[model samples]
Target: MKTVLFDYGNVVSLPQAPEDVARLASYVTGAEPGFEDRYWEVRLDFDRGSLDPAAYWSHVYGRPMDGAGLDEVVALDVASWSRPNEETVAIVDELAKVGVPMALLSNMPVCVAEGIDTLPFMRPIGPRFYSGRMGLVKPEAEIFHETVAWLGVAPGDLVFVDDRLENVAAAERAGLAAVHFRDAAALREDLKTLLG
Candidate 1:
C-alpha cells in the first residue's frame, strides 16, 4: 500500500512567526540579535537527540541555563513552532476523510514534537516519526530507509513531502517518490497527479 509521508515543519505546520521568534530571543540574556540564525545553527544536533533540551538551549544562548529558565525557554520554543498551516491541514483532513494513509516525519526536537503532538490536526496522521525520537535527521538516507522499513512499504510506494529541497533530494535518492513542497495549491496539484 502507498503511504503519504508529510514533513511537519513548514509543510504541515506554518513557519515559526517572527514575533514568536523574537519573544523566544527575549528570554536569552545577551543574545537578542541574530537569534534565529543561532537557533538553526544548533538545531540539527537537538533534532538528532545528540543534545538534550538544556544542552540545546545553552548552545543557542551561548551560556548555561538554570532549570526554571530552561523550562521557560523550552516552552517558548515549543509554542513558537505550534502554529498549523491551515491550507495544508485542510488537505490532510481531505485525505483522511477519503481514507488515505498518511504519516508525519519531522526533524524536530523532542520538546517541540511533544507540543506538536497535542495539536488537533496531528491526530489524523498515523505513525509520526520525530528525529529526536528516531535519533536521525532528514537529508540523511538512513532516516528515509528506516521510515520505509517501519512502514513496511517499498521505497517507491511511499510518497514523501518536505519543504527542503535537500530532504526531497535525499528521499528521491532513497528511491521514494518525493515532492518539494512549495505552497498548498501547488502541493494539491502534485498530490492529485501522484495519488490519483
Candidate 2:
C-alpha cells in the first residue's frame, strides 16, 4: 500500500489525564441535567463543521463562555486528548521502514489537533487530516478521498485503520482497504499481516 490513514483517538491515543468523559458529563449536567448524551452529538457537529465551535460550545453550556472559561475548556478537553501509544508508534515506525507514506485522519478538535505538531510520531506521520482543521468528519466520504488525494495514492493503494465501525465502513465505501482497530496487540497483528 502506498498510503495508510490512521485514526488518532482510541486507535492511537486516549485521555491522558483521566476522567475526561466523566468530567465533561459533569460540566454538561451543570447546563442541562441530562445533556451528557448530547455532548457527543455536539462534538460531532463541531468536527463536521455543521456548527461553529464557539456556537456549539455556547449551546452546550447554555451560555457563552468567558475567554478564560473557553481557554480552560479547550485546554481541559481538546489539548488533553492524550499520549501516544508506544506500540502504535512502533507500528508506524515499521510501516515507515518499508517506505509506506502514512497520514493521520482523526475527528479532533482544533486545539488538540494543532498540538499534534509537538509529537515526534506526528511530525513524521505525513500530513494529518484533523476534522476540525479540514472542516470535515469521517464517514463523510470526502475526507477519505481528500486524504488519498493528499497522499497522491489511489484509494486501492491505501489502508485505513479506525476504531469506529462506521468510519471503517466509510473507508471501505470510499474504495480503500479498511481495518477495525481493537487495541495495540490486535492492531500489531493486523498491520504485521498487512505490511509484513
Candidate 3:
C-alpha cells in the first residue's frame, strides 16, 4: 500500500502570518532590515536540532537572550506558524475517511512541533517526523530513506508532497514519487491520478 507523506509548513498549515512574524522580530532589539534573511540563515540548523531554542534565538537576534525573553519569542514563533490551511486540511480529512495511509514530514523545531502536534487536524496523521527530533532535514536523501524505513515501505510506495521543489526533487532521487504542491486543488487532482 502507498502512504502519502505530506509536508507540514505551507502544505498543511498556511504560510506564517506577516503580523505574527513581525511580532517575533520585535523580540530582537533594534531589528535590522534583513531580519527575515537572518531568520532563515540559521533556521536549518535550528530545525536539525543542532541548535536549541535559546541558541537559535540568540543567533537570530545577533545577541544573547534572557530566559523570559526567549520564552516569549519561542511562543510567538510557534504561534506564527500555527494557522491551518483549511483547504489542505479538508483534503487530509477526506483521505483519512477513506483510510488512506498518511504521514507528515516537516523541518520544524522541537518547540514548534510540540505546538503543531496539539492541533486537531494533526491527530489523523501518524508517525509524524520532525527534523529537530531526527537530526535531519528534508531535501536530503537520508531523511527520506529513514522515513521510508520507519514506514516499512519501499521508497517507491510513498508519494511525497512538498511545496518546495528542491525537496520534491530529492524525494524523487530517493525513489519516492513526488508532487510539487501548489495548492489544495492541484494537490487533490494529483493525488487522484497518483492514487488511482
Off by over 4 Å in 3: none
Candidate 3, residue 145: how far the Cα is off, in Å: 0.5
> Per-residue CA lDDT of candidate 2, range 1-196, in tens?
4577899987677544447655654664476565555666588878766776567777777778657776676666665566777788878887787788888899876766766757666665867888887878888999888888877878888788999999999999999888999887898787767765
Error of 3 at 17 (Å): 1.1
Candidate 1 vs 2: which has more lDDT = 1
Best by lDDT: 3
Q: TM-score per candidate, in order? A: 0.97, 0.86, 0.97
User: Relative to the true structure, how large is the alpha-carbon lDDT of every model?
Assistant: 0.91, 0.76, 0.91
lDDT of 3 by residue, 134-195 (tens): 99998888999999999999998899999999999999999999999999999999999999
Of 2 and 3, the candidate ahead on lDDT is 3
lDDT of 1 by residue, 1-196 (tens): 5779999989998888989988888886679987778888989999999999988888788899768999999888888888989999999999998989999889988888898899898999989999999999998999998999999989999999999999999999999999999999999999998898
Ordered from best to worst lDDT, the candidate numbers read 3, 1, 2
User: What is the TM-score (0 to 1) of candidate 2?
Assistant: 0.86
Which parts of model 1 have CA positions greater than 4 angstroms off?
none
Models, CA RMSD each: 1.0, 2.5, 1.0
Clashing pairs in 2: none
